[model samples]
Each structure stands twice: as structure tokens, then as C-alpha cells.
Target: MSAITLGAVRPRFRPRRISPARWGLYAFILITALYFLLPLYVMIVTSLKPMAEIRQGHLLALPASPSLAAWVKAWTSACTGLTCEGIRTGFFNSLRILLPSVVISIVVGSLTGYALSLWRVRGANILFGAMMIVAFIPYQVFIYPLVRVFSFTGLGQSLATIVTIHTIFGLPTMTLLFRNYFASLPVELFKAARIDGAGFYQIYARIMMPMATPMIVVAVILQTTGIWNDFILGLVFAGRDNLPMTVQLNNIVNSTQGERAYNVDMAATLLTALLPLVIYFGSGRWFVRGIAAGAVKG
Candidate 1:
């Protein structure tokens, strides 16, 4: 009862309402983030270190004087095999495959989505369902059959064949994405356009497609990453003369008898990852919004 002056009490300064489980969740996230970032940290540090340091096995030591020599070597002089011509030889090869693959995949995906979304074409739903079913299957399973088909069609191991292979592999997910997105859009828009004497392509191009920027961005992200990072498909379809940087990187990293330049290997890996990382960073605002979530939900 001494000095018992409980006026307003200040609510006992109640601790902010964060449970132990929530705290644990945050702790888990922080550890997980550190775990993922470890590789990047190692690479950056190692890339800055000279080959001398790399050979000395100081994997995490800070460089005494940071240099871009490793990066330069990776760009213009490192050898995949005997030739020290660097990874630049196939830079054009990747671009040749990457550009056409991205463009054609988007076009085919957009068309397929538009058709499946708007038109009541016969067997359309069945075909779409089949596509969805096939989407879940690992692409490796399709490679043998497709390789045989392409080889027979005389498109074997060419850029065009690689592009087609990407489109085929990309079809299901791309179609599903756009179809679901279009389905989420108001049907009245398409109906009104139809009533105004607009044809399918007209409505699609002039009206609906304009509103599909988000979905398209999402599709671009998926296709760019998948097709760009694609080693196996590019390896099997892109042929000897057209081996992508990924294939070159594999050769550099995996050459058994040849001395592995870990520093250059790290730099090369970072370089190879730059494109997809660019796409992700560029469209980062909309990239966070899951493409199909709450899209059409009432």
C-alpha cells in the first residue's frame, strides 16, 4: 500500500504481441537467408582473390588487393578445354537461341491462351486439359521422343530446333498461365467486343492483350529463366557449334584432367546468372505478385 498511486497504470507496458513461434519463424528465415547468401558471398570473395590465393585454399579470405582479372579471364581468355578463347565465343550462340525462343514462346503461349480462354472451339478444353496434365511431367521424359522427332525432321541440333524445343517445353505452363489470367478477366469485355463486330484477333490484340501486361511479365520471367539457364535442352538441341555458355561453364568446371580455375568458375557462374537476375530485378515490382493468385477470385 506504500505509494499506491495507480492512476492510468500505463497498461503494464505490454510487450508487443509476437509469439515464440513467430520469433522462431523469423529466426528460421534469417538463418535460411544466410544459408542461401553463403554461396554468393563465397563467390564474390573468391572472385576478388587472385588465382594464387585460390590455389592456397583460402576460400573465404579477404583479398589484399581486389582485381577484376578473374572476371576478365572468364570473359575473354579462360579455356573450356585446350583453347583459352574464353566464354565469349558462345555469347552469340546463346543470344541466337535465347531471343527467338523467348519471342516464339510468348507468341505461341499468348495465342494458345487466347484461344483456350475466349473461343469455344471443339476439343479445346480437352486439349487444354491434356496440356495441363502434361505440365506436371518432368521435361527429361519428353527429351528422348522430341530428340528423335527433331532428328528425323532434319532440324537436329540447330538454333531453330532449340527454339521449337523451348516452345514445346514451355507451352503447358505458358498456356495455363495466360488462360487462367484471361479467364479471370471480366467476360463482359470480350462479349461486348464481340457484339461490336470485333473478331477474335481484333479483340485480343486491341483490347484483352493490352490488359495482360502483368501476366506477360510473369511469362517472360519463367521462359527467360528456363530457356536461358537450359543446359540439357540446349546441349541436346543446340549442337556442338551452338553450345551455350552453360555448356561451356560445365566443361570448365568439370574438365577432369584439366586444372579447374575456381576463381574463373565462380565469375563464370555469376556471369551466366546475370540475365535471369536482370529480368527478375527489372520486373521486380510485379514479379512479387504471384501471376494467378486472387486474379479472378470473387
Candidate 2:
């Protein structure tokens, strides 16, 4: 003790240890994650299960023998009505409705938002406010009037009509999304472009649009998911010849007299989901970056 052990007292070294509250927060996060993921887990497991096992009600249980036969039958031979044609018949129809609507909606919405955000055109604010207000209205309120208009205009129940309908319905939300996004951007960006002799279209197409990649991805996601998942609007306007997969799916799942094929039904659901799924998975990385880039702000 007399050896002057002050050297041992040198700043009691302590490692950075996590506090108990942090550990509890991590535990809470894990539980929340599991809660949200439960349904997805059930769907995957159930989809892999055969009808015999599915009927047994242990939907979460591992498949007795995993097979892709349901997926195959769903693609080529599962019945929808009087025919054995599967949901593949309507995949292209969905695309037909999706592409034109997406392109037209994005182009028009972006232009409208850019104008509303940056320009000082007369009555523009009024129009923008009206659009935003109407965006919150349930779409059903407009369907009857729209149908009457479409009928009078001789565009009733056609691909063109559906595309136009999607464009119209998508406008309010699309405009709001881009307007808010563009508003958050620095005004200096537009002014610098203007000083460099950039005109309206020039600034939009060059300086603004390039930086708008994130918002564009968001728009694509929303429009793609909506148009692809659409059943009601497509049913009303997509004509018998152009029925999307959802309509086919409804028929398959609901036909009272038809023998219910659960396997095919699951596969068809998966197929119908493919478009939106592809968009999400493909652009997920950009979506993250774009959000981080301040596409949506407080």
C-alpha cells in the first residue's frame, strides 16, 4: 500500500455500454417489425401450401411437400369461366391500361405542379386549392357523372377511356405531390436557370426534371400501384374486351357454381400483384435516396 499505487487510479477506463432503455427500445422495435411482417409471412406459407393442407387451417405451417404446380396451372390452364385460360390473358390488358395512364398522368401532373409552384399565373392558386380540396373527396362521388360524360362523349368502356379516367383521377394527387416537392426545392435553382436564358419548358425539362428523379419514382409507384390494382374504375370503363386481371380474379374467386381452385386463386393473386411488386422492388433503392433527397418534407 505504501508503494504509491496512484498509477492504478489512472482514469477508470469504461467501455461505452448500452443503457437499459436503449435495450428496451430495441426490443420494442423488434416486436413491431414482427407484427407487421406476420401477415406477409402467412401469405407466403399459405400460398406454398396445397388446398388439402390449406383447408386444414394450419396455414402458417410449413408445406408438406412444396410444389410449383399451382403457379404453372395459374399461368396457363386454370379456369376463369367457360374456358381454361388463366389470368395471363389479362396481364397485357392491365399493361395497356397502365402504360398510357402512367405516361400521360406524370407528364401533365409534373407540368401542372411545376407551374403552380414556380409561376405566378392568374387564378393558378385558386385552381390549385380546388384541386387539393377535391383530392380528398372519395372517388365514387365522381364516377356516376364521369360515366354519363363518357357515355355522351362515345368513349364509354374502352382502353382509351380507362386511360383518360386514370389520368383524371390521378391528377389531384399527382399535382399535390409534385407541387409540394417542387416547393421544397431552392428557388435559386429556377432563377439560375432563368439567368442562363432558360425558358419555362427549358428549365423544366433540363434543370428541374433531372433533379426530380425521386419524386418521379414516387409518382410512378403510386400510379402503377393504383392503376394496376384498380378494379372498380376498370370494371366501369374497361369494357368486356379489356377486362383487367382483377376483374378476372373476382370472377375466379366468386363464381358460385364453378369449382373453387384455391391453388389457382393464390397463384392468380400473386400474378396480379407482380406489376406493383416489380415496381417497388426495382426502384426501392432510388425511392430511399429520393425520400432522403427531400422529395417529401414537413
| Ten-residue stretch with the least lDDT total in model 1 | 289-298
**What is the number of backbone collisions in each predicted candidate, taken in the order shown?**
0, 0
* Model 1 spans > 4 angstroms off: 1-27, 290-298
Q: Candidate 1 residues 1-298, lDDT tens each? A: 1111223245666556899987998999999999998888898988877878788767667887888888998889877778777777766778888889888988898889899988888999999989877777876788899989989998888888988888988887778778877888999989999999999889888997899987777677777777778888888988888888789888877873657777888887888888877877887644444333212211
C-alpha RMSD of candidate 1: 9.3
Error of 2 at 28 (Å): 5.7
Winning candidate number (TM-score): 1
| Model 2 lDDT tens row, 1-298 | 1121223455876548888987898899999999998866765666677788887768568788888778788778777667777778788889889999999999999999999999878998899888877777887898999989999999888999999999998888788778877888999888888899889999989877899887888788778887899999999999988899898878766772645667667777888887777877787655444333332221
lDDT of each: 0.79, 0.80
* TM-score computed on alpha carbons, candidate 2: 0.80
135 in model 2: Cα distance from truth in Å? 0.7
Model 1 Cα shift for residue 126 (angstroms) = 1.1
